[model samples]
Target: MSKPLEQNFVELLEQHQNIVHKVCRLYTNNYDAHNDLFQEITIQLWKAFPKFRGDSKFSTWMYRVGLNTAITLYRKSKRTINTQQFDTVQFKISAEEYDSTEEDQLKLLYNAVHQLNDIEKALVFLYLEDKNYKEISETMGITEVNARVKMNRVKTKLRTILNP
Candidate 1:
């Protein structure tokens, strides 16, 4: 007797669902949009799981599918994102833990990240995840050299955005 493949998929997805959440967070600003994108990414992962061979890690495959789904939907969806100050809905904090300076800086950084194009944002997200150039190239379907070049450019862009 063997455990079913669907069960295995469920278990693996449960273990790695945080990756999907991170993707959703990077790609979507609003809570509603985050949940929506999360659901879509999970569905895409489940649909593609059957074809998954163990050549690479499950988490690696999830990154590719998650990023592709997010990038594709992000490009197709035409919607306006309203920027707001003190967006309690998006950044909830308890009264005790509230620090205006830290919160403001975090908000500023997020705004800077949101300014980047989809591919650049993806590159930044992968880099933050501590992925190497080779891993990023594999996840992004680009050569390692390309990933390194894009990452350096993105870093410079982020510095300019943050400082200026």
Candidate 2:
């Protein structure tokens, strides 16, 4: 990469690194794995960045590449590892305002999400990020209708996991 392109990539990546982090969190089991996957995604993004025409927003393009990397290159055998505990302050919630019940529920939700297949997890991640069906379809290279159908099935699967 040229100096100017390198600088541009660094600036844009810094601005939208959270998308990579979110994808990393959804796909990996432990902190080490998360870091590894994040690194891999960043590397993949850097390699693919030169091909990125200004057809979509940088963040949107980042999502497509990030998801593809996670699904295709970074997937590993599922492991039943305990989820990492996070401080409430990290999430910007006051310690005093924290509810253990809600926290437990959140953990359960993540646990369920962690159990989903790679493709299902990608769907859930996009859905949680408020990406519409069209964007999800575009990101996953599925038809819009298939994205909607898969999302509904993912939702149903999550509900079953939570309620059963």
Candidate 3:
């Protein structure tokens, strides 16, 4: 890659790296898996960057690429699941951000989210990020109605998981 293009890529990636982190956290079970998925997502984003037309916001494009990489390229072995304690998992949230009760609730929510299938997790991630149905459909390559339906189902599933 040319220096200017490389520089631009670095700048954009630095600016929107949180999107990658969010996807990685949702997709992976532990710290090592999170780091691996983050690297893989970054590589995929770099490879796809040249083809990124300036049509959508860079963050929007990043979400599409990052989510696709998480769903398709970074598959985990179903037989060898490694669970980590919620406290050990480092996400964007910090210890001081919430009170103990809120922290416990957040942990429960993340645990419930981790139980969802890949597609369902992606839908929940986008929904939590405030992506509209159109943006969710564009990112996931599903119809808007399908996205809505899936999101509703995911919410119902989450409620059940939390309540149970």
Candidate 4:
């Protein structure tokens, strides 16, 4: 990491911090593990920065990198499962009263998503992020039909969890 590249990466991180944080929170429920994953993703993104071409938008690239980093982290560490299962605290909706209920609903949705597998989490995250089936498929390396099917399955899973 050259000085200028390092500086530029810091700037990039600042600009896209929300995407990384959102992905991290969606992928893991444990605060410590979430922070670790966020750091790991940041490192991975920085390591892979030089290879990034001007082919696609930076955010799209970051999304791909973020998802891949998270999935890879899950694959590499087996401890997160037990830790995640033990800590099931429900996250409160912290927005203003006007939209707080909606925020709480979204929080519950993400909580359910947190219980899902990595691939499933990625699917639900993409869906919530408003990525169409085509883009989700491309980012996830799955077929468009499969993306739609998986997204439908995610919605069904959420409905079951929230309703039951």
Best by lDDT: 3
| Native-to-model Cα distance after best TM-score fit, residue 61 in candidate 4, in Å | 1.3
Q: lDDT by residue for model 2 over 99-128, one digit each (tens)?
A: 899878878888889778888989999899
Which regions of candidate 4 deviate over 4 angstroms? 1-4, 80-94, 97-100
**Candidate 3 lDDT by residue in tens digits, 1-164:** 89999999999999999999999888777777789989999999999999999888888889999998888854545432344467776656576877889878878888888888888989999989999999999888899999999999999999999998
Ordered by lDDT, highest first, the candidates read 3, 1, 2, 4
* Candidate 4: clashing pairs of residues: none
* Candidate 4 whole-model C-alpha lDDT, 0 to 1: 0.79
TM, every model: 0.85, 0.87, 0.91, 0.80
* CA-only RMSD, every prediction: 3.1, 2.6, 1.8, 3.6
Model 1 alpha-carbon drift over 4 Å, by segment: 1-3, 80-105
Clash counts for all predictions: 0, 0, 0, 0
lDDT tens per residue, model 4, 1-164: 68998888899889988889878876676778788989999989988999988576677788889999988877887645532442254334443543767757756665677778888988888787888888888788889999998888888988898899
